[model samples]
Target: MQKQWLKWFVVGMLVFVGASICSRSVHADDSLQRVKEKGVLTVATSPDYPPFEFQVNQHGHAKDVGMDIELAKQIARDLGVRLQVKNMDFNALLVAIQTGKADLAIGGINPTPARQQNADFSQIYYYGGESFLVNRADAGKLNRQSALKGLKVGTQTGTMQERLAKQKLKGTHVVTMDKATDLILALKTHKVDAVGVETPVAKAYVENDPELKDFKAAYQLNPKDTGSAVALPKGATTLQTAVNHSIQTAKTDHLFPKYLKTAGKYMQVNTANTSMWHYWKYFLAGLKETLLISVCAVLGGIGLGVILALMRLSSLKWLSWPALSYVEVVRGTPMMVQVLLVYFGLGVFINIPALPAGIIAVTLNSAAYVSEIIRGGINSVAKGQGEATRSLGLTKADALRFVILPQAFKNIWPALGNEFISVIKESSIVSIIGVTDLVYELNVVRADTYRGVAPIVVVMVIYFVLTFTLTRLLNYWEKKMKHT
Candidate 1:
């Protein structure tokens, strides 16, 4: 009887494990059902590449309008779901899809074999060639690929063009930037001899700026290398099928030309008013987001910091050790890594939006530094004060609340204020994750207007004003505290 029972138990365990595997498989491939259930297909893209995906100011409101966005709409329509676009850095787009932040990524992605290992891709929707953008004065000399042999060539980071430039352009220095606009800026500033970009993108820049001109930068190409495709999560076969179908429909109906035409009109409108004042609404919106993230992060950091400080101060080994470790770990690493980890690492369990992720990361990062500042402030308080409270028959918690904390806060006030200022400045890093902080909007305005330095100057002035005003306010508070 015992042997028979053990045999049945083993069989039951095998069946349960098999069922679990099957369940996960279904979940992985249920991308289509997930979209329909939510009634929205979230598409991710880096909108800094024009004619492929870029933003335009429409009646004082910024809107995304490009061929890639149009294709996303087509896919969403075929899936019977509304389309929701999420703008992120180009490097973040594939990771966004892999982490379930979006249903698909359509930012003129090349469906290379290396990328295929990470995410499934749809049929190529658009075929494009490469070109090199150079100053018109040097166009005759640097027009061909061979001419770039010993010059600096700039490409957008994480792009096929970057890889090609590095691999194929022997004796040339290859520089990579996060945005196509930045690459153009580099070329114009003479930091790079030429900028490698998509043929259409190069044409768009050359048409707008007479100083720039493009010529073919040919390569020994594969079919996948020259075309753009939509990326989906790995094992999302159903979603890939639907997206491929949408691509086929667009191709059969000859809709690519129409998409490009629509994008060109928006681009023309965008360039019509390149003055910084014309895009005041964009700057205003960005300022609000920056303030919101900074204020929330600082406030939340203070609260968490107090708790951590208390934990570190505790006599209990477990509490104090963990608190110490957390502070050291957070302090030791770069904040950018923390931001990505919180945005994508924690995303494996929960889908946090970019704004909240930015806030959480900054809050957590600030807590560590704030905790150390608080701990130092607490230490600065006279030990005799604690003894005096104890002699008065006050409990430890009451002593901390009434005497120690108030004095500690008074001591740390200036440091805390400096932290607030630091957060306001450092918070610009959140732009990489698509939070519309002032810096993010600065890049958007740069791309849309194609006037990089002007937008940068405007953002720089705004940041200076903000930090200077904050410094004056902090000085005022410090004086008030001293009097108190």
Candidate 2:
């Protein structure tokens, strides 16, 4: 009878696992089919780019409408597909299509050779040049591109501007600020002598700000240079051709110019050139830092958590309550508040700087949660396991190490992975303290170019790629560990 029951239980578990796999496969297939059947192309873009794409909060949820966005929508309409704009960072749009997460990227993306390796590009939509923006005082002194040779120039990291600075203006000291906006601030505050940015961006800035009127564009660098195009994933040949036809139709109708005027009404000139790429970089950087912090915190927290968990599970009330209270206080408050308290608030009482304070804060917070996971895992181990170890002449510590911990860790592995991912997403908040991770970069880009949408879309793609990659790696490790 017992054997029959066990056999039935094993069969049921196999069926459940098979069902889950099938369900996931079906969902993925359905998502792809729905796009084709409904004739709706989901294009991800960062609407932060002015004259390109930016958010219009007409009702409540933000709607993206800009030159590139309208162009994309028109393209979709031509293809008989309803255009669904998924607002994101520039960098993210590429990754979205690459990862089979989105259909295409349509935000003034320059179809560089490097990008083309991973994605296909439609015919060029917009042609533009790159230039440098400097303070009025500096502009006069550095009138020529050659004059900027020795001066510190800021540019959005990973853009064609950065590439130009490295290749064409080798001697010029280049500071890679995360965003064009931040570059502007750096110039405004005398942090950098000038910023290498696109021509339209510089023109928009000088036109919008009276103070910036003094800051002239120091001769157009890389004139009539690059063109922007919509990017589709490498395997998406059908989608690419459709997008190309759409671009051709839109150009004939001069739809982009009309859309630009409509989008320009709501966008601030200061935040326009913020592209998706800028934001993607920031988010990826943030994800990396968050992962680093989470790993360090989890390791530190596990060590401390184990000790606290043991104490809480101890017979002595005195030992248990203090540890329990520490856990309560940490778990009670939001992680953001705790992060601020440690990084900023505690600066009054303690002189420890930002990075260390952040590490300590995250570690403490992680420890509280780790303690609960540990406690639950420990409790899940049958009492017999502990008794068996004790009966074999093992001390409490030995029993935990040899018997209890092994089982506990296995049970909590999935939960630990979840916590790690959560920490990664949460790390964006650290940018508030000037941590230059991901979001900080986005703010900088937004401030300078005023091409709002592209940079943010870029940042989102980077983060998604980073977090998704990490999650996969962790899952692989977990599976390997389980087998071991």
Q: Rate the local accuracy (lDDT) of all candidates.
A: 0.88, 0.66
lDDT of 2 at 197: 69
Q: Specify the highest-lDDT model's number.
A: 1
| TM-score of decoy 2 | 0.54
RMSD to the true structure for each prediction, in A, is: 7.0, 16.1
* Candidate 1 ranges beyond 4 A from true positions: 1-28
Q: Against the hidden reference, what TM-scores do the models get?
A: 0.93, 0.54
Q: Which lDDT value does model 1 have at 53?
A: 89
Clashing pairs in 1: none
